[model samples]
Target: MGTIWTPKLNSYSGAKYLRLAQAAADAINQKELLANTKLPPQRRLADALGVTVGTVTRAYAVLEQRGYVYAKVGAGTFVRAEESEFKNKQINFATCQPPLTNQISVLSDAMSQLAKSPQRLTQLMAYHGEPLKEHQLIFSQWLHKRGITQQPEQIVFTHGAQQGIFAVLNGLMQAGDTLLCEGNCYPGIHTAAVQLGINIEPITLSDEGLDLSELEQKIIAHQPKVLYITPNNQNPTCIQYNLSQRQAILALTKKYNLVILEDDVNYCLSSEWHSPIWSIEQGSEQSEDPGHVIYLSSLSKVFCGGLRQGFLLVPNLYALKIKQAIHSQCWMISPLNTELACRVIQNPEFMGQREQVIAQRQQLCIEMGQRLGLKQRWRGLNGWLQLALPLKAHHVVTALAQKNILVRNGDDFNNHQNFIRLSIGDAADDKIFVQQLAIIEACIKSLSQTAYSVV
Candidate 1:
C-alpha cells in the first residue's frame, strides 16, 4: 500500500465523480469533514484518479454546479458548510455535469465574431452602456418563446440572476417590508431575504403549485408587497402551476397590488412548459398593470452556469429603477458571458440537447416511479424525487449514505419530517442512478418500519 494510487471511480461515466462528490458531501453533513475542509487539490485528485486535470476540474464543476462546493479565488475549492449540510443525504443521483456538447462551438463562433467586430467591442466594453440591441433581440426570442410579450428593450442584463434578485430587492422593498414566498422555495432567496432584514412569509403548497387560497389569505392578512414564485418546475418540489392557477394568481396579485417577482429559472427545461403568468395577454377584464411582474432567468440552466449570465425582463415602468439598482450593486458582467450565452441560445442543436435531457428525465422519472413510488415522490428539474417514507425518510437517507449514493433530504425543502427529496433530475448518469436508487429503495424497504432522525 506504499506509494500506490487507487482507481476510485471513472470520470468518463460522470456518475463516479458525482458519487465521490456526494460521498464527500454526506460526510460533511455528519460533521466528519468539519467546517472549511480543504479538499484534495484538483490536480492531486486527478493524479489519484490517473486522469487529466481537466477531468478533475469537471468533477469539481459538477459539485459547484449543484451548490455543494465553493471555489475561493486563487485558492483551492472547499466544501461549503451550509450547502454540504443541506445536501447531507444519500443519493444515487449524480452531480449535474455540464457537458461541453457541440453547442459550445456555437458560443465559440459568437466570441470569434465579437472579437472580429470592433463595433461590438467598442460599444459593449464598459459597465455603463446598454447591451447590444442584437443581444436584446435574441433575449426577446427567449421571452416570446416563454409566452412573454416583452420588448427586448425591457430586458436588462446582470452578472447573474442572483444579482438580479439583489437589484429587484434593492429597488422594490424597504428593510422591513415582507416578501411573501412559496413554503418550499429556493434557498438562495431565503438567504437573500434574511440578509436584507426582510421578512419572508412562506405560502403553503402541493402538487398544484401554490395554495392560491392560502396565499391570498396571507396577502390580505400580512399585506406583503413582493410575491416570489417559481411557477414552473418549482425548485425542490417539481410542483407546477396549472393554467387556471396562473389566472387566479394574477387576479390575486392585482387585487392585493403585489409586485410579483417571478423566478422562472427552469422555464426552458420542459417541452410542455406553459407560458408564464406575465406572458399571458392581458385584456380589459385582465389588463395586468405595468410594473406588476419582474421576470428573472439565467443561461446557467440552458447554457453555462459558469457563464454566470442572468437576464431580467422587467415591466417598462419599473425597468429604470431595477436597472439603476443593478448598476449600483452588482454592476454589469463582462460582455464576454453575455456573448457566450447569446451564442449558445442561437445554436440550432441547443434545443435538441434540452429535448434529449427531457427524454432522459422522463425515463428517469418513470424508472424512479417504478423503483420508488409516489409515496414520497416529488419530481422537478433536479430529480427532486421526494420519498413517501415520512419519518423513515431520515433513516432511508442515512442507510443510503452507507452505500454512498447521494441525495438531498426533504426537510431542506419543507420541515416535513416524513418526506425525502431524491435528486434524480438534473445532469446525472441516469442508468447508474436508476440502479443505485433501486439499491437505496431496497435498503429503505429492508429497514424496520421505524423512523429515527439521524441528526
Candidate 2:
C-alpha cells in the first residue's frame, strides 16, 4: 500500500461492515483512493476503525463483490481499475421488470411437467374464445391474495399490460373521445392515445400524489370518458398514492361518471400490499353501481417477461366490449403461455423466491445510491434521480450511453422534468449493478462540474 488510509464511517448509518464498505466507496468516488491502490490489511483497518477484524474482512469482501476491488491469493486486496469500454455491450437500466432470479428454471420445470401430459398440452395448444375456466379461477385466486376480489367472469386475458392498455382504450373510447391522466404518466398511455386518435388531458401531480382539485377541474373541463392511472407505484415517478388519495380518486370517478383504468402491474414487486382502488370501489355497499374501475395487472413483473401474460378485470357492463376488443385483435392470448403462467404462479416456492429477489435488488440499488451521494426515489425495481440544476438529464444519458450503459431520460415520460429513470431488473448481477452505477456517478459528477464552469 502507498500509505495507510482511514475511512470515516460516522455519517453512515448501517451495519458496521456495510458502513465501512460505503466509506470506502465514497473515498473511491472522491478520487482520494485511486484505482489500483492496494487496500489496508484487515487487522490494521479494524484497529484504525476500532472495530472487530471480522468486520473489516466482511467489508473488504463486500467491496470485492461490488466490483470495487480484487483480492490476490497471497497479496492484499487492491482497488480494481475503472472500466472504460464495454465493447458495444450495453448495461441496461431502462426497461422495468423483476430482477433475474430462478424464474427461468421455474419455467423450465413447468415446461417439463407440461411435456409429460400430452392431453393437457394438446388442449393448451388449441384455440378458444377465452381462457379455460380453471386458469381464470387460478388468476382469480391470485388476485384475491393481492386483496382484489373480482370474480373469474370479470377477467379478460391479453398479451401483456401494453396490450391490455390498448384494448381498454379501444373498447371504451371512440376516436374523438378524451382521456384524463396524470401530467407525468406512463409512456404507454401516450402511445395508445396517439394510435387510437384519442385526446389526452393531463392533471397535475403534487408531492403527495395527484392534485385532486386539478383532476376534478380537468374532468369538468374536458368531460373525459376515462381516466388512466397507476395507483400502486406509478411508473417513471414511482409515486404511490396513499389510502386517502385513493379514496378521493374513487369519489371523483363516481362524481364525474368517469371510468378509471387502474394499472397495478408493479404491485407484485411491492413489499406491502395495499387495497387497490378497484377493490375499494367494488366493496362499497352504499353504491348501487360499483363498476367504475377497470383493473389491469400482468405476470411479467412477477414471473417472466417473455411469457407476455396479462389480464384485465372489467366491470359487468364493459366486460363484453373489452373482450370483443381483445378477440378482434388476437382472438385470444396464447393458451400455452397462459398455461405456463398458471404453472409458474402455482409453484410452492415462487412467491418467496420472488420477494427475496426483489428485496435484494432494492437493497443493492439503495446502497449504490447512498455511496454515490445521488438522491433517488424508489418503488419496487424502479427509481428516479433528479439531476441538479444546469446538469441536464439528456447529457448524463448520452454520457452513460458512451460507456455502453442505458437508462431512460425523464423526458420520455414527461417533458417538464430533468431526471432519469433507473430499473435494476436487467442488471446481470449485483457486481455489475454496482459497477454500472459507479460509472453513472462519475459521469454525472463530470457533467455537473462542466455545467457549473460554464455558468
Best prediction by lDDT: 2
* Runs with alpha carbons beyond 4 Å of true place in candidate 2: 1-88, 267-269, 370-375, 451-455
Each candidate's lDDT (Cα)?
0.66, 0.81
lDDT of residue 354 for candidate 2: 53
- Candidate no. 2 TM-score: 0.79
* Model 1 lDDT at residue 139: 80
**Mind giving the per-residue lDDT tens digits that candidate 2 earns over 1-455?**
53489978889865687678878877877888888899998988888899999788767776775567888988889887787333245888888877654555467668889999999988887788877999999999987886788899888888999999999999999998999998778888899999999999988777567999889988888898899988888887888888999999989888889899999887435555577899998889977767899999998777667889999989998988888888889888888888988888888646535565567777777776676566788878788888777888888888788888899999898754788988877764455667777887778777887735231
The C-alpha TM-scores of every prediction are 0.72, 0.79
At residue 373, what lDDT does model 2 achieve?
69
Q: Residue 227, candidate 2: how far off, in angstroms?
A: 0.4
